[model samples]
Target: MFAPRVALASLSGESDAEWAKACARPAGAAFLGGVAVDGPTREAARELVDRDREEFLPEDPVAFVDDQLAALDDEFLRAGVNVRATGLEPLREAAAVCAAHDAILEVNAHCRQDEMCAVGAGESLLRDADRLCEQVAAAADEGAPVSVKVRAEVDGVHLPTLAKAVERAGADAVHVDAMDSRRVVRDVAEATDLFVVANNGVRGREDVFEYLAYGADAVSVGRPSRDPGRVRPVYAAVKEWFL
Candidate 1:
């Protein structure tokens, strides 16, 4: 059986202390720096295209980049924070930040917001698999374990292709945004030798177990982290089932 591990969702805008509290969760194994390359909210994101029309290019193409990098740096400076991993764009600065922090770096290719695509980040990489592979390889060459996070397509044809490409790119793992049912996710996992982590819609112990059984090496929980009181029980349950 795969051991259950926790990943905290969306911490890019949060302060270091806030990130530390989430990382301190006993079951937590990784932290996704929530740098929404797109707008922070749905309504804001919808305005991205219209907003872009007013400028020659997207306004503040990387508006969120600096803040996200700062948050990652802050997390790194905290003592005994145990933040072994983080996710970011595979840019030179992002690679540098991950190296300085001694954290495994994951490329964010799962974001589906229009703003992200408009700015040529996130799922936009899916359209250019070779470049994405090159970027991941570059990060790996820099002594950081490069993982790529990708959303599973609705039709499922692209998932296998993306998984295989990441594996060939020398990535340490592939984080699958498994918003679909557990059964569908399991089918995708069966096709890859690379380490797989399931994210999206994982609410509690049973969901975690279902993911593990489906071949996820780890599972990430989102909303549960907002309430600190819920972390222990979830951690305890994971320990009970698969530790």
Candidate 2:
């Protein structure tokens, strides 16, 4: 599990290694740099990412992932370094890079972008539980710690069941974008043994404590952590809670 119990969720714009490093604090872990893979399944992801998101495409995704992990060499030595990535083709490859670099590799299943779903990446996996489980299993098999980031409410998808699936598939942790539902985090926590990292709408110390009270092992900060001043209070609260 991550130290201090505070995590920087894989916010689209903030996920680059450089940006994540800049945002890192002594008490929290920064989930750095998300990458898209090569293949037709990535076209829609590319289109969607091109609009407002900062997505990275390296000719070799494994190298790109390795480079990103390597970029955080100094930070890795001092704090936890985790990477969140999408795309079906490179879970194992990315996991390998993470293993090589001693970083955590998180599979992104929380993105609900229309374009991402159109390409069968992102939250589309929520609708395809079997495939997602397989991907996570493969990544975990690569000898790297794997965390699956999943959305709570997605119409027909059952959050607790998916959490169980991820745990059964060997994922070390489950990162939940709880959205407006703290109950989903509770349910997932109850259903699985995996460490639960609660994400979404975590604005202040209250939100952090609220999620932890609901059974989250850790809490992730998204939009609010974008401001340096905002990070201190949240970090202090998390540190205090852990203490």
Candidate 3:
């Protein structure tokens, strides 16, 4: 789980420097991944990992995951790191790596990429509640403290029900990309005791306070997270609230 205040939402497979930079800032925790996972060595996370070996996505996802995790310095380790993975098989490997590193393993049910969806991964898992819970359970079974990241307002997806199911599966937390519906955060909070993290377009201190008021244990900053300045006020606000 994250510290008090805001968290950094997954920003794709960018760079360890970028990740370290974020964690070095004021955010409570940083979520890494949306990492692709099809088979053990078969790379299928086409979005971040194309045929070319770009900045972050390499040929082997398992190795790539290790490299990304290894990039986290002592400061990041203490701040908190949650890794998001797409497929179940890949999640298994990710869970093992997270367990070893004392990090949180998050199952990504928030991605909407067509290729990942075609494989029953990403946001596609939201529609398949059983599959999503199964993946979450599998990650937990690996002895990894698991969290499920989900997007609310998606067609046909019942946020509350899905949250309860994730709780039943033994996930340690649920990160909700609540989008425009901040109320979903309260609903999910009421549904389960699992730590609830609210994510989306959190602009300033007001939005952060609003989500917290809605029962989010913590709020996550997405696009604006690249700049630490944006979250400083939010983190300050949270700390002040606790005082």
Q: RMSD to native for every prediction?
A: 6.6, 2.4, 2.9
Task: Mark the regions of model 2 whose C-alpha exceeds 4 Å error after superposition.
Answer: 49-52, 76-89
Candidate with the larger lDDT of 1 and 3: 3
Top candidate by lDDT = 2
Residues 1-243 of candidate 1: C-alpha lDDT, one tens digit per residue: 122366655433342335445545454444544333223322234454466421112244233333333454534222111111112342544455555555556776765656655555567777777767876876777666667777776443377777788788877777777776556567657877877778787767787778888887777656666665666666665676674
Candidate number of the best TM-score: 2
TM-score of 1: 0.72
Better of 1 and 2 by TM-score: 2
Clash count of each predicted structure: 1, 0, 0
Candidate 3 lDDT, 45-129, residue by residue in tens: 5443574432234567666666666666455432233333445666788788777767678788886756556666678889998
* Distance from true location, Cα of 161 in model 3, Å: 0.7
Clashes of 2: 0
Q: How do all the candidates rank in terms of TM-score, highest first?
A: 2, 3, 1
Q: Distance (Å) between predicted and true CA of 213, model 2?
A: 0.5
What does candidate 2's lDDT look like per residue over 163-191, in tens digits?
A: 88888888988888887888789898899
lDDT for each of the candidates?
0.56, 0.73, 0.72
Pairs that clash in candidate 3? none
Score every model by TM-score.
0.72, 0.90, 0.88
Winner on TM-score (2 vs 3) = 2
lDDT of 3 at 83: 39
